[model samples]
Target: MAAPVCLEYRIEGNDFMVAGAASNNIKNTLKMLGISSSVCTRVAIIAYEAEINLVIHGGGGVLKAEITEDRVKLTAEDEGPGIADIEKAMTEGFSTATEYAREMGFGAGMGLPNIKKNSDEFNIESEVGKGTRLYSTVFFNKQ
Candidate 1:
């Protein structure tokens, strides 16, 4: 595609039923545009994890995907109780997910790690009371 394509979704906190919708939509968009399967899978994982983070931790937020010829950028922004320690939050198996969320099989503490793993570039900024924002990029040509 010559022009960039942008997709955005509003994710609600504790909304289990609609948690995966935004990620799926982003993946489908990549596929429809003939993006490579590997890239699509990576982007899908990033999007899904970010979406879940929004629902389980962010107290609702916005998830966005920007597709360009060379890369896809994903952003998850939330005005929820933000992370106090980004480093700890990024640790695998460390989570603040509610008991209800755990019962629903939603929180395993892998969200940030997984997103980072699949992203060509990843960044996160959060404030204790303000909110959190995550940026992840997946390159289309990375083999």
Candidate 2:
């Protein structure tokens, strides 16, 4: 395990073109840091999903990464019309994205599930009129 490293990224709302930039940068950083390939892959997937969610559902947000000896933590905070129904939003095929988002091939309603699947731990909080925040962690296994 290496020393703890912290990374942060700002996600622009409705920016489809740069939606995955933060995740890509994080992936590359992990690779350069010599993290395990499997770990990096999982992180990349979760990060990408979370990033897209920020762009699609968040209106705009920020992503924070904290790397420790045992795990990597990623948190995304966005300021958008909060999710009206958390339960419905979690459904596989449920989506409230605008036509433009859908046209961009995003908002398939799989982002949250995918992030949860790839992370060791996941938590989400949202306020109807405020915004949403997601916290995810991927633990590093001692081989």
Candidate 3:
């Protein structure tokens, strides 16, 4: 594609029923664009994890995907209380998810790690009281 294609979605906190909608839509869009299955899967995982983060910890936020000829960039931004320690948050088993979220089978402390695993490049920034922003890129031809 010569011009980039962008998809954006507003996610609501604690909205379990629609939590995966944005990620599923992003995946389907990539598939329809003839992207490879592997790339699509990676992007889907990144998007899904990010989406869940928005719902469980973000208190509502925006999820965006920018598609280009060579890569897909996914971003999740939220205005909720941000992480005090990014390093700890990135650990596989560390989570700030509430008891309700765990009971609902949503939070397993693997969201950020999974997103990073499937992304070719990933970065996250946050302030304790301000918010969080996540940026991830998946190259179309990368394994």
Residues 1-143, candidate 3: write the lDDT tens digits. Answer: 77888999999999988889999999999999889999999999999999999999999899999999989999999999999999999999998788999998977899999999999999999998999999999997631
Cα displacement (angstroms), candidate 1, residue 68, comes to: 0.3
lDDT of 1 by residue, 1-143 (tens): 78899999999998998889999999999999999999999999999999999999999999999998899999999999999999999999999999999999977989899999999999999998999999999886632
In Å, residue 18's CA in model 3 sits off its true spot by: 0.8
Best of the two (2, 3) by lDDT:
3
Which segments of model 2 are wrong by more than 4 Å? none
Q: Among all windows of ten consecutive residues in candidate 1, which has the lowest summed lDDT?
A: 134-143
Local lDDT at 61 for model 3: 99
Off by over 4 Å in 1: none
Clashing pairs in 2: 13-59
Model 2 lDDT tens row, 1-143: 54788999988988888889999999998888788999999999999988888888788899999888778999999878888888888788788888999899987888877888888999989998799999999998642
Query: What TM-score does prediction 3 earn?
Result: 0.96
Error of 3 at 4 (Å): 0.9
Error of 2 at 94 (Å): 1.2
